[model samples]
Target chain A: MTAIAQQRKPGAEAATTRTRGASSGAAGGGRYATYLLPAAILFIVVIAVPLALNVYTSFTNWTGVGPRQWAGLANYRQLVHDSEFWASMWHSLALVAAMAVIPTVIGLLVAAALFDVIAKRFGPRLASVLRACIYLPQVLPIIVAAIVWGWILDPQYGALNVGLRDAGLGFLAHDLLGDPHTALLTVMAVLVWFQLGYPVVIFMAALQRTDPALTEAAEIDGATWGQRLRLVIVPQIRPEIYVVLLTCTVASLRAFGWIYALTSGGPGEATQVPSYYSYQSFFTNLDVGYGSAIATVMTVIIVAVSVVFLWAQRRHAL
Target chain B: MSAVLTRRRPARGKLARHGLAKHRGPAAWLVLAALAVLTAAVLFPFALIALNAFKPPAQYSAHGPLSFPDGFSTGGVSTFWQTADFGRALWNSVLISGCVCVLAVLLSILNAYALGIGRVKGRTWILGAFLVANFLPQEGLVYPLYDMAKAAGLYDTPLAVIIIFTVIQGAFGTYLLSSVLSTFPPELLEAARMDGAGRARILWRVVVPVSMPTIGVLLVFFFIWTWNEFFLPLVFLVSNSNQTVPVALGTLQGQHIMNPLTTSGAALLGVFPTIIFFLIFQRTLTRGVTVGAVK
Candidate 1:
């Protein structure tokens, strides 16, 4: 800006190093619309048209390449009666419990413990080191983690089973992932391991940024650690708590990489999720219309969830 | 306990040094011990990967997974790498993720300039549309995108994946940057504009430089997210030549070519590059997570 101002190319408004004219061009008045045209065009080309086509395709019957025939909610009616769809829906809710609700609860306690007790009594270095160890897995690609977990939970010659038998708890060992009874439970456990670090990192950072005086004040006022947590720390970080829950829930709701690598929807669809289910239909079954319907329904749920969270956030914080 | 403490002043810092941390002896040790156990539990899988990555298949079968390796071996890693053609996969990942990051950041900056700084008419609706559009999972767009990419003759190229992710990532970036820029000090824009600078000049010379920190965070996120992407790349990059690291590793799993040693080997192959990025950008990544948690 300064360089341009100094060129003085026979135009007006030379650079004046003064504090005047501050308010004139400060609130830029809408000549910026041309700048947005490129992004808007790209967005429409890439996402918007496809999104609309997806919704449209849901109401038609067509394979990947063919003339379309209108099915008009017939796919949706099929969705309602589909047992596997319901099971996948139910499994998605269970994942929300594992990845969002439970993690948030555990993360809050772990974060507070690390912040208040660990950092205070030990040092910031030790606390951050522990935090990093927990956070290390999160930075790895999800497919990698899923692959490693699949190996660990393998039915034969796997570590968990091998270790269990060695400890004379052989009865406790089973085919954790290959068995339908245990597949979803095993998958959910892996997700919890993968998901726990996010809330811990976010919540801990939120705690660090907030005024510590509040927690100290509660502590100095004869409040026990538990009471101080309830009265001071948790309430202080409510906005962060909300943010973590919303993002985690949204991520869990549409989680794909881990499931795709591990179960691929399963030993009898035990671990099927909406994302994987839709993919299977699209490519495996060649039922493009039904797949689009599943995806559209998923979009509706995610948008609804996001809107509710954002509205509540606006009311609470904004 | 002191009048100074109740005033919410610096005296609290003094008391904190000598206060709670000075007490709690056995309890503190117990807490430390528990945290150690928790860290070990969290790291159990990675530990398993490291221990098993070097074991030969014959020894792995003979001794069982729980046994210590006889010695180091690269047989598994080499075999998995050869089978997967990991060199090409790495190159493909680097190209795709890097292009997506650069393009997406520019798109984000431009979109944010209009909505946040220009305060364009109907900006709120535009922003909402972007949010909804991006949040619509890749599943919703996967089939159509596949068809479109095929129609455009981009079915098996890195360019197609690069272009698609740019828009998807850019939409979310626009939403985030708009909020950050809304509070951008208007005085800077005012001074630059008063100098007869055009919008383009001011954006590059002033707005972008000033907002570089947030932009850096956005860049880091875009690279990692694009690199980690699976479902879209799995569908679009059907040929082995264009496959990214995760795609190559993931698609090879059920091909009946894997054994226990190679499973650990494959996991390591997939995770190595990301581990380097995580270490290099450790602090920034942690900081970025909090920034991204905005309402």
Candidate 2:
């Protein structure tokens, strides 16, 4: 693959930089080759080869432990009929809403409130501290967040229920993670909590560059806070909004550690997303082919979503 | 600054003295109060972990979850570490993430040099490949890599994680550093070339030193990421001794499912390094969050 990629480079260079001959282009390519070699080799061995192999393996009937045979779309056919697969896809979409959309909206409000109102009224020091506090959860490992939240939601001695009961809200307290009906929503809530900081930080950073004069003019013109936020702040930070959306979209789709640590897709698969489902099918069930098919479909979906978002952004910009 | 605050102090104080309304209106106080509450809610879990980590079970159960611990005890913390073999796990994490940092950064510096400065042909394609590769979910790659690791006898070893993380991070590092280095002033490189410095020397002397700050930020991110990584380690390393910290804590959580004290202790132990890392490099971490979106 490296040789092929390298061989194709000079022809392109010769065409693009037309004044350069094939010999000099090859020499320039060789010079750059040494710089590119190590990353290319590692990328191929670890990522490219494995991904290619997965696409092939999806077509085969390979249990993880044994020899493989070409099954000819059997796995994909099984996925078409798999209720759990479709359910997980739905769950992922729900997570996208919970983790990406909801957080972006709330984060914008919080960050704008902090930067424009609180920072101005109180002090920058307080705002900085608050930003750090909000971002703290994001810095911790997902597994740690999962474990901490898992303990909090524990039925018997969990802090959440204990606090609820103490506060005389006993009727509201229940097994948030263990109940099938509430499990997925509960996980989504935790994810939203975990995700708020990313957008908050991103938006706040973007707001730092916002033209203060526009906001000042709006304020002086007796525009309401809501009006200023809608008409002034939001427009300045569109790119950051898109950034948060894309990052959180990928994050929620690939979210595993939290789900795995929190409930292990429990309460009878209520909280199971495709990532966890793929893990179960490939590793636990030893059905490598089925797992690979799920994984491939998931990859396609994620890439497709990304492309669509980028296209939308370009269109919006134009 | 003090003059402005002093001058505005009376008006702000008068607004506050009026109760709900303020210079900005009722929402000003409401938003501030709401933000304070949100900050508390966000920090509440960590506070729970810290407060409950050392509590004895009998005392903990008797006092209930919200009660302040009667006193400190290392018993739970010790138990968590011993059972989870956290010392081994911590060592494994350090070794693996350390290797990943070195390998990922080195490879990316070279690759970024090529793409960002070398202006190599097909640079855009190579860069696009790296960007797409970075976004490929781990689920899609883990199974095949699992098989490959088993084939190569690396499955359940630190080396497997090191190699995989290095590659994953190599893509990111390239994307980040290439953008960072691409912003390097062309005149400097031109001057170096005029002085007959070769590509390697120019990169090492001019580009590396000039880009060290960005590289440092990437290093911090890569280290925290690798240290906190849970999924790949869970899939790749099976044994207790070989498992990284997150994996070790995860195993401990499974075995001691009902023991919140141990879980809390292990959770604290698992996240301590990253907490320390963030506190130290807080600036860079925040910068990475937004600046990372830059092309």
Candidate 3:
């Protein structure tokens, strides 16, 4: 009986091995195609098909309902002289710059203090609560945030002006969204406020992972807090910093929903980002070919910015 | 007790050597205060929105921005519910987001499993493709998608929104899950194989159970993202009944801008589900964002 059991065990093992080998071989050869098929089909049908069509449509002068006349590079050429497009792109850059600088600097400091100083007492609980509160805006649909902000910044009977008058600071209260001068700034402020929590959380998380012993050693060697921070903590989380910068840049460039909801790219196209401009060209103007050109330019800009940022990250790593 | 004393002595010695103990005192408080202020800055706007929701439309504009509503009223809430297609929009949102969450999670799991565990060629390229696709702005493809959806007779349908969202979302979903899967120890997978489990059985019995937390996190994230999506739905669903909450809210805002009462009421109604969802998944969402941070 013992001999028979031993033989049965080996036989079962061999069978399993054979099956595993066969299956793994098959999976190695064609499993990606099988597993990837659903996503691929969906991407092709939905994303790729549209992307291809967009490229084709960009070359042609096609309204939403008409036969296409090949415009070749006219759409692209027109975009060069399209002052509105250039202005919107400039506005987008300003927004990205504003978002990156303020949030990153504040977030880093807050994260450092949270981790290094306040970590001993109410750190974990406070971190969680603060995180939730900060991420609250992320969950609110952009329209609600924009509209509520609109009311708060309303020139007439707006909350901001009302409070400002009461405090004898009424001079600072402009019709923020209505004035072309302040419209971009107001929109950027709202964007920054909405996005502040995410970076804070990200920074906090990255800060926690920073090695305490390194900071302690630097301290023991008489390095000041600021010096230690510059040398040790910043270098350690460079990758995270890069990620935050890239994400913030992308987000600011794609600043559509709030701009749409708040100003509708108005106060005379002052707050018009490329995204809103593209949407206007496509749906409002019903100029498919021109819209496609605008969108393609937007895509190229995003891709270029991302590539540059990534390259900078790699350069920093080296 | 001995270990605690030893640790304390060293920390005290270090502080004394640096003469930094006094400086640390106010610095810590300063840090705390700054964090508190930042937190308040973020929370106050949402508070304004919440406060306004409970007030009468006239009173909301009449009162100080920070003032409490004159009286809490379900009048606006009830009116929002009855007059608008809020209910149907909410149902459509729930259905579409739920379907997207399920489809994305399932498809991502298979792709992640194969890429993370199975010996597959071109895995790096596949991942790179997904990353590039994810980073491509949605506007780049919107017109083409609109044209294609129209050609296939899918324009103005919920399915059109679902398919577009699923594909766009899946790219990122796959990337996140694949990273999570790569962290799963290979030893356990090998052990499961040695224990006579087949690939399907291993996935079901071991991989799924082990990766539950990640799966949960992805579900909530995907659901929230899909639920909050506006532009795609706005472009695709032209029919009033097919309008999701965000699109409906946008339309409502345009139509009722002159009527602050209905507009504020609708805005309040539109944001309710999202707030409720956040509260429900607060724990998971927090953990999900901070997961790779510490470890």
Best by TM-score: 1
Q: Count the backbone clashes (under 3 Å) in each candidate.
A: 0, 0, 0
Check candidate 2 and list the clashing pairs: none
Clashes of 3: 0
lDDT per residue (tens digit) for residues B1-295 in model 3: 6555546656766665457434556656777788788788887766666776667666765665567787877666677667657888888888899999888888888877776656356877787677668778889998878877888899999998888777777787787777777567656777998899977788889988999998898888889888888888888988778888888777666564434455556667866788898889887877777663322
- CAPRI-style grade of the A/B interface in model 3: acceptable
- The numbered model that scores best in lDDT is 1
Candidate 2 chain B minimal-lDDT segment of 10 residues? B13-22
Q: Candidate 3: where is the Cα deviation over 4 Å?
A: A1-27, A121-123, A167-172, A310-318, B1-24, B61-64, B195-197, B256-258, B292-295
TM-score: model 1 vs. ground truth:
0.93
Superposed Cα deviation of residue A95, candidate 1 (Å)? 0.6
lDDT of 1 at A234: 81
For candidate 1, the chain B TM-score comes to: 0.94
What DockQ results do all the predictions give, each relative to the true complex?
0.54, 0.42, 0.42
Q: Rank the candidates by DockQ, best first.
A: 1, 2, 3
| Full ranking by TM-score | 1, 2, 3
Candidate 3 per-residue C-alpha lDDT over A19-113 given as tens digits, one digit per residue, 9 for 90 to 100: 64466657564644477778878878776777778888899998788788999999989989988888888988888877777778877876776
Alpha-carbon interface RMSD for all candidates, in angstroms:
3.9, 5.3, 4.5
User: lDDT tens digits, residues A202-268, model 2?
Assistant: 9998999886656665665689989999999998888778878988999899888878888888888
Model 2 docking category? acceptable
